[model samples]
Target: MKIRAAVLHSIGAERPFQDTRPLVIEELELDPPGDNEVLVQIKAAGLCHSDLSVIDGNRPRPVPMALGHEAAGIVKAVGSGVRDLKEGDHVVAVFVPSCGHCSPCAEGRPALCEPAAKTNNAGTLVSGEHRLHRDDGTPVNHHLGVSAFADHAVVSRDSLVRIDPALPFHHAALFGCAVLTGVGAVINSANIKAGQTVAVIGLGGVGLNSVLGAMVAGASEVIAFDLDDSKLALATELGASHAFNSKDPDCVEKIKALTKGGVDCAIEMAGSEKALEFAYLITRRGGTTVTGGLAHPEKKVAIQQVSLVAEERTLKGSYVGSCVPVRDVARYVSLFQQGKLPVDKLLTHTLTLDQINEGFERLAAGEAVRQVIEFN
Candidate 1:
């Protein structure tokens, strides 16, 4: 079938342009689903930082890959023996899918499922073949199995998270990645108790959601830190009790004073070493710091083992908020439906597949919180 996609033939350095670039939206074709998979007609997709990292050249990716991970859509067709789901189910596509019998999945940690590397990152499904292709029948590798940048995608049934009929497609797409990462950081990884003081460094898509998660978890105080004043204000609206501009000279002092020495939990959503350092330093004795962001591979972290041992502090690195996507995605959708999670406010703008290059420019300009690509 003919489909429009933001195809990347080469890694983007800065931003995508509409002027005859092969790295942005070079229209392509899509194939039908095979065994244990389903064909989805994508309705909406969320722009995520992970996608940006590739374009910025921070995260190197394979060429000729269709870029998009967070998405929600309707089932257009289901492959053989797919009994649990059928056509017309409103669902959000998860980037990771557990084989259920794999070593990691059997151990109850599907987040570490090895199939993720081969299926999503490598753009080949379990059958060792790709779904989408050019009209001339050349392979255009699928990105993350759910290349929602296109009008349709063929993905594993395990990657599909069915949601309630009440949730909006655009908002539900965010739950697929951002909400899961942020809330999972608090509830799953940290297991934060009530009345604890929390500090969140970085107030972008993931960080703001972490602040929201802290509020929902009944934390006594949620201190938000960000370089952008607009994001600081957005953090407050989302649930932060306080906001701090890290660009200011007294940012660290303000954070220290607010916590009466330091906070009980510090979550670093920024992938920078400096932010990770601050997250550790601002934590009191026995406090925990969780770094959930994906940093460049060559980046090194500096730490004083003495301080960690002497203060009895713990540091953690999290992926996708340590989530089991099937369970977590539904919970997030319910929260949105119940009016507890104001996901709509997190949206800054929406663009089309053709305009994705421009959207990246706006993201670099810090003009929007997220720029979603509507795959209608």
Candidate 2:
């Protein structure tokens, strides 16, 4: 089948992306679903920083690849051996496709499925197949096994979680990445107890979700940190007890004073080594610091090694918010439906596929929270 898709031929494109035009919209051929796979007609896809990382060369992947991973769509067809889902089912696409037999999957950590790690790095489906190609017969890699920046995509069933058909596609798209990563970090990773003090460093879509998660988890004090005052204000409006500018030289000092030493759990979602350092600094003795950001592979943070031993500080890296997508997606969506999560506030903009570059420019500029491309 022929599909219109955004294809990135290379990495490290110069910004303004609107001018450099890194992702070329091309007509590509999409193959039929194979065993344990599904053909989906994409309904909505979100522009996230994870996608931006690839464009800016922070997280490198094989190109020319069809980009866009955070999405929701309608299953149009199911492949052989796929019995649980069928046409007309609404679903969200998960970036990592877990093979149930893998060690991580067997241990109830599907986000770290070994086969998924290998296939994602290789830019192929969990089955290690390339389903996209240029008109000239050149293969285009799949982005996180989703390649959802198109009208249609063929993905492994493991990459999809069926959702309630009543949910709006634009809202459902966020559950795939931002909501899962941000909210999951607080609930699943940090496991903040009632009355615990929590600090969130970064106020992007994911960071804001962490703020909301802190509220849902009954944190006594939900502190928000970000360089953008607008984001800080938004975080406060969303239930943060206090907001601070990370760029303020006295930022750490103010937070420490406010919490009488620091927060119980500090979550870093800014995808910067500096942000991770800030999160660590704002964690009180014996507190936890969870980072779900994806910095460049070459980037590293400097921390006092002895702090771990002396203070009993716990620093943990969370991927997909340490989420079990099948379980968390449903749980989070239920929270959304009940108005406890209030994720709808995060949807700030909606664009057509043609406006994708402009949407990305807004994302890079920190002008938008969650922007979704709505398809008809």
Candidate 3:
């Protein structure tokens, strides 16, 4: 089948992406679902930092690749051996496709599924197949096994989680990445207890969700930090008890004083080594610092090694928020339905596929919270 998709031929393109135009909208051929796979007609796809990381060359992957991973759609067809989901079922695409037999999957950590990681890095489906190609037969790699920037995609069933058909596609799309990563970091990784003081660093879509998650987890204080005052205001409106500009020279001191030596759990979603360092600094003694950000592979953070021993501090890296997508997606969606999560507030813009580059520019400029490309 022919599909209109955003294809990135290279990485590290100059900013003002609207002018450099890293993502070229191209017509490509999509293959049918193979065994244990499903064909989905994408309804909505969110522009996320993970996608931006690829565009900026922070996270390198094989190209030309069809980009876009955070998405929701309807299952149009199911391949052989896929009995759980049927045509017309609404679903969210998970970037990591867990093979149940893998060590991580067997241990109940599907996010670290070895096969998924290998296939993802290789830019192929979990089954090791390339379903997208140019008219000239040049293969286009799949982005996180989703390639969701296109109208339709063929993905492994493991990459999908069935959702309530009543959920809005645009809202549901967030559950795939941002909501899962942000909220999951607090609930699963940090495991914030009632009355625990929490600090959320970076107020992008994911960081804001961390703020909301802290509230849901019954945190006594949800302090928000970001370079953008507008994002700080939005985070405050969403339930953060205090907001601070991380760029403030007194930012760390103020937070430490406010919490009497820092928060119980500090979550870093900013995808910067500096942000991770800030999160570490803001964690109280014996507290946890969880980072879900995807910084460049070459980037590293400097931390006093003795702090781990003296303060009994725990620094953990969370991927997909340490989420069991099947469980967490449903849990988060339930929270959204009950009006507790308020995931809708994170969505600030909706654009057609043609406006994708502009939407990305807004994201890159920190001008939008969460932008979704809505498909008819």
| Least well predicted 10-residue stretch by lDDT in candidate 2 | 129-138
Between candidates 1 and 3, the lDDT winner: 3
Q: What is the TM-score of each predicted model, taking all chains together?
A: 0.95, 0.99, 0.99
Compared with the true structure, the alpha-carbon lDDT of candidate 3 equals 0.94
For candidate 2, give the lDDT of residue 261: 95
Q: What are the runs in model 3 whose C-alpha is more than 4 Å off?
A: none
Residue 300 in model 2: shift from native, Å?
1.1
Give the Cα lDDT of each candidate.
Answer: 0.81, 0.94, 0.94
Tens digits of per-residue lDDT, candidate 1, 160-208, equal 8898867878788888888888888987777789999998998778887
Write model 3 residue lDDT over 46-101, tens digit each, in one string.
Answer: 99998998998989999999999999999999999999999999999999988989
Q: List the residue pairs that clash in candidate 3.
A: none
